[model samples]
Target: MSRALLIIDVQNDFTEGGALGVDGGAAVAAGVSRLLEAHPDAYDLVVASRDWHDADNDNGGHFAGEQAPDFVATWPEHCVAGTPGAEYHSDLATDAIDIHVQKGQGQPAYSIFEGTTPDGETLSQVLADRGITDIDVVGLATDYCVRASALDAIEHGQHVRVLTDLVAGVADESSASALAELAHAGADVVDSSVVAA
Candidate 1:
């Protein structure tokens, strides 16, 4: 069986200097790039994901409209489709990614499991098609997308690992909690150094 890497939501909107910027987002992007540079052939498949919310609608009540966002269920306007914020961060080595999955098109999608490729393939389909038995996850907002994606990967019956150094988060406390949850769910919480090809 082959192994795959899931790079989740390293978009400009989630990175530093963009809308809804999270701390260390830019660092995560750069670190992911460096990791790929150091071990380009480590995984058989490398899939990357992003938030591609539609610009017209409020994304199925995901974006708070004229009301204060709770920051849990509702959030500020970010990563709208066709916008620069939706694009991957400049520091990310997009060329190394094999597949691109876009989620939350006019909806609330946190997990990469909720996403599909341009060719309309679901994340699980891609994994199944590629015969992915082990999954390595990394990316932005560790407490949110990364957390959700890791959990879903486990649910999909794949041996999962989250590259601790390769992700950023919106908040520290929640991020720590999310990591604990992932570990409790049987995902290996490791550093990027452990991912050598």
Candidate 2:
């Protein structure tokens, strides 16, 4: 079975010192890079996603606007398209990525599955076209994007594994709960070390 690596939202805004930064986000970036460099052939396809929201508008109420951001359904303005914040973190080696996905163009998007490639192909379409049957998920904000992406991958009829060490989250409790939920949903929650190149 073909395997793919799904790197979710390892962007500047999600890393330390940016809007909605998560603790250990930068480490996840570096770790992911190392994984790809060390296992160049481990995955048939390497895909990375970023939050590319529209700067001119609230992105369909995704941004809190005049109201304070509740950090739940609404968030502060971040990762505007063409901005540095929307770019992937420097620590993540983008040269290794075969596909780059941009999500939340003008709406609230948490999963990479909600994104599209430069060619306008959906992630599911890309995977199906490539015959990718197994996926290894890793990246920032585990409780949000990583969690959602893995669940969607499972729902899409793909085998999924979440590399715990390669992800960071917004909070401790929520991240733990999200991991538990993923495990319950049939995703193998494990460390990147367990994966063989």
Candidate 3:
């Protein structure tokens, strides 16, 4: 099985002490690193994504403006390009990543599919070129980017598995719902241990 590991938004701004910090983000980063360490051959490709939003504007309404952020469609200023907050978390093993993707540069992008690599190749193209048929997703905020990424993976005709234990989320209630939705949408909501196994 050709599998790709998609690490979504394990960035500074989404970790424990940054702008849109989510609980357990650090643990997820470390867990993913350990997974890769234990199972180096588990994935044919390793892709990590970040919310590299532009600093000047609201990023096509991805950020709040005239009113308070509803925390759903709009959020507070975060992950601005060239900022430390836009960088991956200290605990995440970014060195092992084969492809790096930056999204939300000037628009609202929830799926990694919306991102392009440094060489300007789309994520879907990368997956197809590499012959990746299965995808294992792990990272911060299970209710948001991680969820979107997994669902999109399924939509793109790939087998999707979400490393539940290797992910954090914005809230318990919403995160639970997101997991349920992902499962219903045909994703395998398994734990990180499954990767090691």
Per-residue lDDT over 81-156 for candidate 1, one digit per residue giving the tens place of the 0 to 100 score: 9899999999999999999999999899999999999999998998888889999999989999999999999999
Give the Cα RMSD of candidate 3. 0.8
> Order of all candidates by lDDT, from best down to worst?
2, 1, 3
In candidate 1 the C-alpha lDDT for residue 155 amounts to 98
TM-score attained by model 3? 0.98
User: lDDT at 185 for candidate 2?
Assistant: 99
Q: List where candidate 2 sits over 4 angstroms from the true fold.
A: none
Predicted candidate 3 versus true structure: per-residue lDDT over 1-197, tens digit per residue: 69999999999999988999999998988988899988988989999999999989999999997779999999999999999999999988888999999889899998898888889888999999999999999997899999998999999999999988998999999999999999999999999778767
lDDT of 2 by residue, 1-197 (tens): 99999999999999999998999999999999999888888999999999999999999899999999999899999999999888899999999999999999999999999999999999999999999999999997899999999999999999999999999999999999999999999999999987773
- Of candidates 2 and 1, the better by lDDT: 2
Worst 10-residue lDDT window for candidate 2 reads 188-197
Which TM-score value belongs to model 1? 0.98
Instruction: Tell me the lDDT of candidate 1.
Output: 0.93
State every prediction's TM-score relative to the real structure. 0.98, 0.98, 0.98
Candidate 1 ranges with C-alpha deviation above 4 Å: none
**Candidate 1, residue 36: CA error in Å?**
0.8
- Highest lDDT model number: 2
Model 3: residue 128 alpha-carbon error in angstroms? 0.4
